[model samples]
Target: MKKMIFVLVYAITTLTIFSFGKAAENEQLSIALSGQYARKMTDASKKLEELDTAVKKTLLFNESDGSSKAREDIWRLSSDIKNSVSSLPLDQSFSTSWMNYLGRLGNYAKEADRVTDHNEYLRVMGQASKNLRAMADEWEVATTGMVSGKLAISDWTNRLDATKSGHDWSGMGTTVKQYTESDFPLTASESDSMKKKELRNMPDSEVTREEAVERFKKLFPSVSNEIIGVETSKSGSPYPFYHIRFAENQSIGYIDILEKGGHVLSFLSERPFGKEVLPFEDIQKKAEKFLADAEYKDLVYEEARENNTAWHMVYVRVEPRYGAKVFSDTIHLKVAKDIGSIVGLDASEYIRKENTHPQPITKKDWKKFFHANVQVVKEELAYVENERLEQRLVHYLTVTIDEHGVIGTYAVIIDTETSEVIKTERLQ
Candidate 1:
């Protein structure tokens, strides 16, 4: 019996030892496979890093003797990196940011290859570098987490700063900043006012349509010589303007003013394909009728005009109804040209229903959509002309949404007498 008991104990010990050994072997196999996969991924990443550096160098400096080859190589490297990274387990933040940066870089490289405008190409490349730095930071964080190792934040930060310094040294960032400062100086409100003044004061011409076409050719060399037709006279203005159309892909239409010393008054581009066309007046009538038919009892039309691309814009105000919340709301209608119909309408502030709660939304409502820490920086009022029966009272307000972000300006037009909103236009 003693011998039998000893044998049973020995058998149990041997089985236990065999099970433990098998588990150890499986773990070792997994570790080996993981290491091999990691090495392969690291090699691909190294190649991508090298390609990225070469592309940046070529873009920053006008280096030749294989710059085109480098550009093509970078595009292929980015694509390969995308495919490889997709197979790896990347979190949303890292995957999204890296893919976006790669896409932007690829686009920049393509543009650089075709671009004759050196300055524009440099500006695009500088932006690409900024985006890349952001992606690299995200990548470092993700890699550290995946390896379960602590990474030095300063290391990543310093690398990004160094890359930015290289861009600065090449004068790429400065060139882009200078170009932007010079090209886009005026505010949207100022631009709109200038366009309106130019249109209103355009002189009428007694010159024949043929003479008008010749004058237009001399004025605008960019547009091809193609006369679609001409309108002798229009109701809104006393002077006659020629309606000239161009080739399909070129500008859609242009108004050649014979009265305004034979100058091309305005040009319009084709709308996104398959859009209808509607006249300016017809759009205004439709908006007014829509508000009138609704419960908005006091619908007032403040301004209506034809914008670029032959789109008509109508600004109107709807007074608050009793037992309905909201003091007033502004409405804008975008009308299509092919048919006298409303293509788009924005009436966010003007929703009114009879059975709804009766108090107007206050500061709390505004806070829901706007940040609490917004700083009001500047304000300006539109010019007031007492002689004109139809006048606009516009308030230009500039505010900063966050502590460090672009200053946003908004144009708030109000009816002075009723304190009703006429229109709200966002400007950057």
Candidate 2:
């Protein structure tokens, strides 16, 4: 216990020193990202440990049904690692290959569904879990490098982002390719095909490739001339898109435009965002204008977060007549804080055909649903999805509850049709 206490104090002391020491004094270095690096390292370590444990359990299980929980844990942890790895200032050369590895791990977790050879699955997953541990260690070293300023600042931050390589997972081929056909990652080929199947009912392609290019140019007129090439997606894929690539003037990225509606399905622009950044309000305005320019309508935001170089935000579409927010139909945006440029966008959720929900037969009384001591602070109508992906109108409640002595605020969703508390999420 004494040793544990001493180690905890030492870790905290080291972090404080790093935050206020010579590294913080460096003009070109970012203290926020340096601090964030420590967090990402810790997260990676925990996730890798969980993933390895889950993989070990799966290898011992006699039947696939018996290992369902462990398999889900493997997939979830791999996804968590993939997201954490994305925040780092990854070297461009290693980013693609690393993502490919993470993706294959997720597919391997579900290989039982396809009746893949159990021996091969056991071998590949065991090795993959070990690889994750090593990767986590390397990331920990990189985090230290960031805080110590031992490596040249330009080496990590020269290009703003080394991530966001897009759907071109051609080079992310894995050694375990022969073990399972679903070895492709979630962001790569397999998930795309699956998602496309889910969205198979989307309107047919009527917009020409030339028209898609014009749309892309209009959305980012400044870098339109920098566009080098545009390629078409697979015919078998649902909602075929034109993958447009652009580079030059520090902006190297791609935009995927649907061939049917010329809608900007998704886009990612990678470039340096130096130490200076605009205020959050300005960033919000910039993102709003870009969405407006894209002709997206009736979107409203409730929160935004700063993610080092960019501000991540989600806006839900509201039904004009009912004023109920449709949580299923949403748009996610990422705006670079440096110049408020729309660096990333994903409107795939919005593009899906609207699912109808049963209209509220009657509004439920909040007082009856809550405990006597609970105080309702706010309430609104919302359309939330159920376990089966079916939509249902619900009473979105924000309330304060005092338990013994402590008070907590929570957001509760009550199904209007049955007056049952379906979900409860702590807001603070």
* TM-score of candidate 2 to 2 decimals: 0.54
Per-model C-alpha lDDT, please?
Answer: 0.49, 0.72
**Per-residue error at 233 for model 1, in Å?**
53
Question: 97-202, model 2: which lDDT tens digit per residue?
Answer: 6655666677567655555576766666676656555555655554555556554445456433434433222232232232223333243333433454356556
Q: Please report the candidate that would top lDDT against the real structure.
A: 2
Badly placed stretches (over 4 Å) of model 1 are 1-11, 61-66, 144-428
Best by TM-score: 2
Model 1: worst 10 consecutive residues (lDDT sum)? 352-361
- TM-score: model 1 vs. ground truth: 0.31
How many backbone overlaps does candidate 1 show? 12
